[model samples]
Target: MDLENQLKNLFPDHVSEKVSEKKDSEEKGIWLQDDPIICKYEKRKGKPITILEGYTGATEDFKKLAKELKQKLSVGGSFKDDKIIIQGDYRDKIMQILKDKGFAVKRVGG
Candidate 1:
């Protein structure tokens, strides 16, 4: 028997709550701020990198945003010093994404 069935057999009177799937209309827990997030491009070690910073929200929220951005862009990245450092120069794409998510974004450096 599966674990669920065994658990049910062990506690017939116990009730289990159904897991809820995230709905599109649900708000992401990240805090919104009036200040525009800064998106910039830089060459570090002769490789192009995109950096996003200036978020005033909780650190965990920023980390989650970084992870989401990396997944959507299909690239490697890191979150450090309150900045999201992406592997490529994706300023336009990243700005669009932040705008779609209701965050103001400012692009810096060509």
Candidate 2:
């Protein structure tokens, strides 16, 4: 006779719809695109940095990807102007990670 009982009493004729578990399990909340994401290395202020771009998705999704990459690589980074700027050179690792996550990655420059 808790919340469930109270709800049933309030709406005896109401039918509760069951949520689809398969759909929820399938969606990662990120959009997958055909074009490959560009991963490039650069030097700003004489410090090496990795930049990821060309993601044709929502900003929030890109931010989430940025956060995940930083955590996985255990490095500092930021999301700016539709791009992810990660500290240090981690092109190979980043590309492998993206590929494993069903993303196509293109490495640019040395």
lDDT of 1 by residue, 29-54 (tens): 77889999999999999999999999
61 Cα displacement, candidate 1 (Å) = 0.2
Instruction: Give the per-residue Cα lDDT of candidate 1 at 85.
Output: 99
Residue 16 of model 1, lDDT score: 90
Which tens-of-lDDT digit does each residue in 1-110 have in candidate 2? 89877998999998878777863453478898999999999999999999999999889889988998999899999999999999999999999989987899999996
Q: TM-score each candidate.
A: 0.78, 0.76
What TM-score quantifies how close candidate 1 is to the native fold? 0.78
Whole-model Cα lDDT of every candidate shown, in order: 0.91, 0.91
Task: Look at candidate 2 and tell me the lDDT of residue 46.
Answer: 100
